[model samples]
Target: MAETDFDLGVVTAPSGVLVLGMASWIDHWSQLGQPLSERASAVASIGGGHVQDWMCELVAVPAADDKALMVRAGTTTSPFDGGPTIAVLEIDLGLPWAGTAGNEPIILGDLPVDRCGMVLGDAVALDSWTGDSHPSTDGLADVTYWGGYAEAAHLQYGGELIPQHGSHVRGWLDLPPDDAEKIVDALKAWEGDQQGRGVMVAVDEHTDFHRFNRASWTHPLRIGAIEVAGCPVLGINWDNGDHSMRHRGERRFGQVYPVTLQPSPEGQTMMRWTIPPHAPVCDGPD
Candidate 1:
């Protein structure tokens, strides 16, 4: 096919930064001991749901480095059943189109699954520091853990911490085979609109509907769409163990649902991060 038009709409911003920003909001709520519901009322006043853009330069070893990967993500949180659920953090990286165009986005360092068990505030605190302050590797690890547990809990109970002391119950989303096909087609359209860019969505699952205490990856599907709901069982950067694994048959027979979109206030908007002036890793061969 002729050069595909990879136009995902100006690539407004990276979803990692946007998701972190949203996570920070939850962090703020968690610190306040609020109910922590993922309802529209919680984020509706914010710019609908802020679509974030993030970019970073990765150095080879320590001091200065070259560009590794470029990424963009988006998400929104709302209350479901008796708790909260987030339909957020859609990721796109490693697209041949973006690389050839000289537009690479860095995936946020992975957050470990173990570390995700910590309070949201702790995770944000760890992520606040830049490479100048802490080893980039460590920071990535922290988030990987955070992403894992956060996703695990969300998919299991539609909330962050499984109701404080109560057991956790996550639901797996198994879209109909036809619906799955439709989602893939939607993503293809999105890629075409996004300058031939590809997209991935990861959702978490609960280990048991009755047990409500453990969780696992039900099914992590790669679909073609602007956005998908539920939690991310598996993270974009899985090498770090920042993600969870889904069950074998969940994708084939679980129930699927639509994610509700919240309204954003006029003045509200998502956050965006530009490449720092002094990137240690840029213009280098990967």
Candidate 2:
């Protein structure tokens, strides 16, 4: 396949710097958001409802530490039902295939169910950063958290902290305060696992419908702090393996519906950190 070139942007941190100098647009979420819908409607017009899911054209990027081990991902939604999900990750890690021949692409990182949760944000404010418990064993790549409901309220996950009333809806528990270091430390652990073993997508094999991925050992764990189109996000990663869960036979990773993930025309901005769930003791794929 021929490749076209484009410079997405650049990111710099104390760990190191990353460059998005990739020269091609693989089948991705943005394409899924707009192009897929147009195609689906076109197919339906001709009385054809079948559309192939988009394929994840594998590309590797260097981590902030320049290790090429840690992966940053993007987001997308199911075609028919618009749900919140990481569509595709535009990793800035240098392009290097995992296999010896450099042909096999790297997989997504699986955050142990006990240690991660989903996070979403725009340029300034994060839409969801619920107070889940992900106790960090040792300091590492982690996000920050608070010890009060006021701060936890910023997070819109896990707990059922009633909106604005500062109370729970019966069974749901109140948000708890936590140490800020836990955020980065837990991230470090998840990234460490990726380094020790190999990167693996943490999503589950749900083949029926697009659902809010559950947290557990069998399902994919969510973790990681990444920027997509200038928005800060944290969630589960996927691979060709997710096709079965998506239940799309048109082809793996080719289907799309409609989603709007536009970056602020003003530019990228940082958002608050969140305490996702913790990884479980049980183990499966690394």
Misplaced by over 4 Å in model 2 are 1-76, 94-234, 237-286
Residues 1-286, model 2: lDDT tens digits: 1122222233332222222110121113234564322433343234222233343221111223333222333344433333333443333333222222433222221111111222222211121112222222122221222332323223432222232112222112111224333322342243323235311212112211111122111222233344433333333423323333442332123332221111122322111111121122467678
- The per-model lDDT (C-alpha) reads 0.23, 0.26
Best by the lDDT measure: 2
In model 1, where do residues sit more than 4 Å from their true spots? 1-33, 38-42, 46-286
Model 2 is weakest, by summed lDDT over 10 consecutive residues, at 203-212
Candidate 2's TM-score: 0.22
- Taking all chains together, each candidate's TM-score versus the true structure is 0.19, 0.22
Cα error of candidate 2 at position 126, Å: 24
Judged by lDDT against the true structure, how good is candidate 1? 0.23
